[model samples]
Target chain A: MMVSLARKTLLHEWRRFLPAMLAVSFATLLQLLQAALVLGIFGGAAVYVSDSNADLWVGYPGTQSVDQGRPIDGDIASLLEMNPQIESVEPFYLLDGDWRGGHGTGGVSVFVSGVSTRPGAMMFARVLTPALRARLAYPESVIVDPADLNKLGVQVGDTASVNGHLVRVVGTARGLRALGGADIVTSLQTARMLDPAPSDSGGPTYLVARLRHPAAASSVVADINGHSGFGRYQAWTAPAFARLSVLFWLFNTGAGAGVLFLAVIVFVVGAIITSQALMAAVAASVNEYATLNALGVGKRSLRWVVLEQAFWVGACGVVLASVLAALLIWLAHSNNVPVAMQPSVAAACLGLVMALVAVSGLMAMRSMQRADPATLLR
Target chain B: MPYSNTVIDPNPMLVAENLTKSFTSGQLSTRVLDDLSVEIGAGALTLISGPSGCGKSTLLSILSGLQAPDHGRVLALSESLQAMDAKRVEAFRLHHTGFVFQGFNLFPALTAREQVQLPLQYMRLSAQEITRRADEALAEMGMAHRQHLRPAALSGGEKQRVAIARALAKAPALLFADEPTSALDAANGQIVIDLLHRIARNHGTTVLCVSHDPRLISHADRVLTMEDGRILDDSDRGAR
Candidate 1:
């Protein structure tokens, strides 16, 4: 009976309750989009590790993120190659560089990734195909993501200066994007040539290894770390390293804090607007409530009616938000805006929305106190 | 001529003794029901008629347990209303009483049939019995054909009839109506009064109504005329 009454009233007076529903929908959409954007932005920081084919990454100790990699002893590669589980090991050079585009276009900060030009190299194996690797084999030739071409003021066949050394843009790739700066992809030889410091000053920034059996990566990493004979470095499974990078950026950065604050504000504002709208709706029907009271409906029963109404309102709002969020997410993807939504994050957002609705329903119960049967006689 | 202050009945459903009620507005206080006493019988349509502010509505409120009297006590269905707590009073009302108001306070969203079924739903009746009672009450009020229409679609009289059917569906022992016909046209008012009369005589339910309209005098089995919070006359016209 409570369900029937609540539903019929909402359907009959839909215009009156639309504001409350929309308030809930707006809150839900904001939470979902915010979470997606946060994941996408932070997830970008780990693209180098995630988009590679490496089963294990051996980097300098305490390397918090892939972009923050330090030079590790090149001798570490031999140690990895000696392991029975390791099929191949390659040196990966990651260095910060300043790019000066041709014709005085502009100067931009960039992360230079220097990898082997071998067709079967484990480093960036998924992104640098055979053709791109062949192009990078040319002297001082580099690759950049097409999306960052304008940011770096360069186009294919253009020449640029990296750390005061001239380099040619041989091609563009899709996954070579970096956080906080553009990415420049070149061969290990070119990167050594472009370096202002002596080539032998430090070894490669990190060593990446491919395993004969991918599933043995965790045990192999454990064994490598336990043996301490491998120089001053740490080894991690590729997934663990990627997750470490993402978590570092998400929790240890100011931008991440700002996104968290925005989420709090969305919840507060959504609760206020939704509760007020629900209260007004209840107040509008106070007379009908009074009539019911006069007919001997108890206060407990009346409270249940309000709760059922809130539940319906929240259900409808969630449906509306799902549709709208899907469209918006598609639009963001088309525009190359980084937005990622995991199933777990979406479920958590849904639980928050239901909690918001429940809080609003409890607040709206105060209006039932006005349903005094004595007022009806007057 | 000597006027009787109370009606004599063999089967009394409501008895009030020296009921006193007052209202205060800032510094001014007005007495609404001044030490009034009455015995209303079962199976009769009783009307308490008076001008505005004469306390007829207050009397009905006290008799129906909607309000507590300041000075005296009321007994409805042989249970002392003042002796029970608020929850007990509500439970008693839920189980034994029905009400109709001047505004025909049917929920605007509900159809005629839904309105009739609302209180029965509160009673937690079986679905089959709820539907059966609602249908029976609507048919009795001649609202069977229009049972699917909402309050907005129904005419003033039709809305009132729905309100009455809502009350009647509960099969309460006492049905209270306040200004039930004041909002209706002459013909619709006639129809409502006749229905109230029929509900009392046919169902053996006590129908107590408070109204200011003198035209309702002819339809009531008894009329208690009031002015300034005191009953001036009680006349029984005999069963119609």
Candidate 2:
């Protein structure tokens, strides 16, 4: 009887609750996507940050992100190396190179990163795996994310030219997208051959110095400025560089504020739907609640029923949102969209939905409690 | 199909001492049940026959521990009704007291059998026990065939019988009916009154009925009339 009664109550409120639930679920899905993208950006940042091995990046102190392919020669690298606390300074062949391929498309913008032959075996330990290491080890090699495989139209054995310097597609690693474009990692030797600069000096455009402590990047940077002949490029920590990337993304694309504004819109739409459903349900069963109370079901029990109903609403909404969000993400991923999915971010999305559910519940709780048990007597 | 709950005192079937209630609508005040007292023997029907606005329902609720009297004490089966807390009172009502309301308070979603099992939730009984007791109660009320029907599907007489079956399913030591026949037709009302007398006589259960139906007075073992919540007329006293 109880189960059936509960089932009927569910049916009765389905009309109002279902729509609100879907709205909430869609909101949840959207929020999840936001979380996934944010986490991916953060995760990618962490991975790149940990790999840099430098205390500080010495840029021109101008833009937030994008090193601008600034070149620092061997003199500064040697000067940083002479520091007591400095371990070693290595320059990379970093440039904004364009790729020209395909049947119709003329060119594609890309960041050509020329890293050390064996940069930090400690940090790139995963990349050093026989399978992956073999790919990056080849002087004629290049790597891109799975998503880029379609755009670049290349496989493991395929070859492509980076700024007229042809390279083989050795392997594909997921992620490693920089500013929605692919990052092509190549050897310093290969970078020297390809870049319109000297390679024996160290970095073609960007110079990264590794320190014994790593934290002493500031002092090491100063020593490089004073002693090394080339001191135009500034040094920065990996995290600082990441913050620069975010700043660049925010200012350049308007993605952050746009997403946050969308979230606000979703929340309002969901709350309005949920409030209407709750109010209608309360009115429909006002007398029923009174009868239940008169039957000795206390206010506390009554409260549980309302809360349970809210939980039901939240659960339904979240599920619906997940479906919608997944569809949206898949659509983007299929259509070559930069939507990233992360587990921690999905959980955070659920948390946001629960918080919204709590707010909606708070709005309806008072009316549920004013059941007035004596109403049945009338 | 018999289920028993231990009555705290287990001596007196029902007892109420100095029960009082007051109703005040702004400045207008009416003192109802002013220190009224009553005691009825077990296994008998005590019909409280009173005019309208007599506070019969108020006194009944107070006695059932659903409502607390401003000045009174209720000792049911010798146990102090006023002593138990809200939860205990509800449990007491669940296992020991049967109630038949003026309107058949059937939960629209439930079948007739399920209506009989509502009180069993308080007992926390097994599903099988609840089912068996509900079936037996329905059978006793001649509602065995209608067990599958909901109130909306049943007639007035059938609904009343279902209500009685629900009350009887508890196997209460004390049965309370507040204007039970007011919603039924004359034919069905008489049938219900007769059923109440039969229950008290056959099961040795005390029945207290509060109603204005004079026809029901004849079926009661003892009848009392209340004016403004105070008992004024007693036919049993003349008989005794």
Candidate 3:
């Protein structure tokens, strides 16, 4: 019966509740899209780690993200190969490049990732097909993300100069977008040739190893880190390195702090608007409430009616927001905007929206105090 | 000759003694009910009739436990309403009293049947029993055919009838009506007064009504006329 009254009232007075529902919907949409954008942008910081099939990554000690890698000794590859659990070891080169397109576009900063052109190489195995990797075997051949072609002022089969070294765009791949600039993929020889100043004398920035027992990567990483002989570098499971990279960018940067502040603002503004609307709705029905008060209904029962109405409002808003967010995410993807929403992230945003509505309901309960049966006489 | 403030009845259901109530706005205080006393009987329609601001409504409010008098006390069904705490008084009202108002005060969002079922929901009755009692009350008020309509779709007379059904559904020992027919036409008003009279007689419910409508005098079992916060006449018209 309580549920019946709450539902019936909302259905009959939908116009009165539309503003509150819209407020909740707007809040949910903002929170969801903000989270997705944050993840999509920061997730790029660890694309190399996340997109690779490597079981473990060996890099310079204290490396926070893949892009911030400092060259470790090339000898680390042989040490990994010596482990019986390690099936293959490969050198991975990361370098900063300045690009000048053939059309004479201005120099653009780019991160050049050089990997083995082997057919079954672990590096970027998920992102780069075997055919695309084979193209990297040719000297001066490079692959870039299609989305960044306009920024680099180059297309496939066009020639470009990187740090005074001429290179050709052999192919274009998707999912190679970077946080601050475009990503340029090439062979190790090409990366070395493009280097104006060879940091660490042309050594690989990191060494990636494939394990025979992929599930044992954590134990292997622990054992390798415990060895005093391998002090020049650190060993991490691929997932851990990817997570570390994303977290470093998310918490250790100004951009991330700005996003966090914007999220807080959205929450505060949403709460205020929603609560005010709910309060108005309650005030509009005060006479009806007073009548109930005179009919011997308890104040506590009236309070439940308000809260139940809020719950329905929130539920309807969430459903509307979910549908709208899904469409917006699709539109963003079509436009090459970085936006990604995991199931867990979506769930958390929904939980926050409901909590906001609950608080609004509690604030709206104050209006019930005005339901004085004595006033009905006047 | 001036009449006594109290009435003699074999079955008095509500008794008030020297009730004094005042309203203060800023510095001026108007005494709405100054040292008034009355005893209303059960199983009959009792009307408190007076001009505007004559304290008839104030007297009814005190007797119904809707407001507390600044002085003296009210005893309803042998229980002192002034002595009970707020929660206990609410419980007492919930179990033994029902009310109808001039505005009809029905929730616009609910159907006639839903308005009637609302207070019954608070009583924590079973769903089947609630439906049965609500339908019965609506039928009693001749509103059963219109029970599914919302207030906006109903005529003023129909709306008032639904409000009466809402009160009757509780089947309380006491029923209070404050200008229940002011919003209706003369024909509807007569029909309403007749229903109240019949309810008092058939259900043995104490019907206490506060109204200024002189046309309703003949239908009431007793009439108390008031002016300037004092009763000028307490006339027993013998059951019709």
Ranking by DockQ: 3, 1, 2
Instruction: Give the i-RMS of model 3 in Å.
Output: 1.6
Judged by lDDT against the true structure, how good is candidate 2? 0.69
- The most accurate candidate by TM-score is 3
Which residue runs of candidate 1 sit more than 4 Å off their true CA positions?
A: A1-3, A53-58, A74-91, A116-126, A130-139, A192-195, A198-201, A207-231, A234-244, A250-253, B1-11, B227-232
- CA lDDT, every model vs. true structure: 0.87, 0.69, 0.88
Q: What is the RMSD of candidate 3? A: 3.3
> What is the lDDT ranking, best to worst?
3, 1, 2
lDDT of 3 by residue, B1-240 (tens): 112232335868999999999999999999999899988888788999999999988888889898999999999999999999998888888889999889988888888999999899899899999999999999999999998888999998888889889888899999999998888899999999988888887788899998998888877888999999999998887532
lDDT tens digits, residue span A33-77, model 3: 888888889999999987889999999999988899988888777
Q: Write model 2 residue lDDT over A281-324, tens digit each, in one string.
A: 66667665554455555556666666667777898778877887
B-chain TM-score for every candidate: 0.95, 0.91, 0.94
Q: Between the candidate structures 1 and 3, which one is better when assessed by TM-score?
A: 3
**Reference-based TM-score, model 1:** 0.88
Number of the top-ranking candidate, with lDDT as the measure: 3
TM-score of chain A of each: 0.88, 0.69, 0.93
**lDDT (0-100) at residue A320 of candidate 2?**
75
**Which residue pairs show backbone clashes in model 1?**
none
